[model samples]
Target: MMLDRVLRIVAAALIVGGTLTAHKSSAQDGAKIAAGEVVYNTYCATCHGDGLVSSGQTFDLRRLEAGARSRFENSVLGGKGQMPPWKGVLTSEEIDQLWHYIRDNAYQK
Candidate 1:
């Protein structure tokens, strides 16, 4: 009887812990997305369009696939076509935040 009771309690605790961890992770993602939006508006909105909506002149960021992180990073850092290199202009953290924001709005996801 006692073993069963202890097991139940442990299982409940594990479930609660997992729930809390997921909530924390979601909150962190939200913050990063928000920060990334700010960065995008400041630097990329002119060419990329507001909210990742392309004006047909530049690439549509929303078309980026879920696995396109490396492609996005390379393009941003090395510059693609008319785009200038942002290697020294944007920080790594900003890049990561931008990725998170873009992924959150990607067509695949």
Candidate 2:
């Protein structure tokens, strides 16, 4: 009873730890965020709106919540709020690269 519970707790910890480790490693190897600056400047700057600082209701990309990364990416690719979707405009790889850029420069602390 007690031993079984302890074993289960240890197993869960190992699984969770392993998952976290893998995710961190993968995120670290994601695309070069600096390269994203040029891309953002070209396609995203006007509305987003100035220097990662917006003049409108555009959410500040430099100050994203850690968990909001996916939702932000979804909104970018599929559109949300006041912004139009870029689903067909940009490839999935571009979207992913943008995510890495934002995640590294803003979200992850």
Candidate 3:
């Protein structure tokens, strides 16, 4: 009887803890996405267009699927077609943030 009560209480606590953890994780992700937007606007907005909207000349960033992270990285680092390389210009963390921002606004998700 006592053991059953304790188990129920423990289960409830675990559920509450998990909920809080999920909320915290979501908040952190939101912050990262926001940071990525800043990086995108500063560096990529010129060719990529404002808020990932392309003007039919450059590639539409939103068209990139979720599994295209490696492709995106390669293009950004090496430059594709007329796009210039960003190898030494942007940090890896900034790239990651840009990915997050782009992914958050991606068509797949």
Highest TM-score: give the candidate number: 1
For model 2 the local lDDT of residue 71 reads 81
Candidate 2 lDDT by residue in tens digits, 57-77: 877787876778678778888
Candidate 2 residue 97 C-alpha distance from true site, Å: 1.6
**Stronger candidate by TM-score (1 vs 3):** 1
What's the C-alpha lDDT at position 41 in model 1? 94
When 1 and 2 are scored with lDDT, the better candidate is 1
Error of 1 at 50 (Å): 1.0
How well does candidate 2 score on lDDT at residue 2? 100
Ranking by TM-score: 1, 3, 2
lDDT tens digits by residue: candidate 3, 1-109: 9999999999999999999999999998899899999999999999889989998988999988889999999999999999999999989998998998999999988
Question: Which model is ahead, 2 or 3, in terms of lDDT?
Answer: 3
Q: Per-residue lDDT for 17 in model 1?
A: 100
Worst window of 10 by summed lDDT in candidate 1:
60-69
Model 1 TM-score is: 0.97
Q: Which segments of model 1 are wrong by more than 4 Å?
A: none
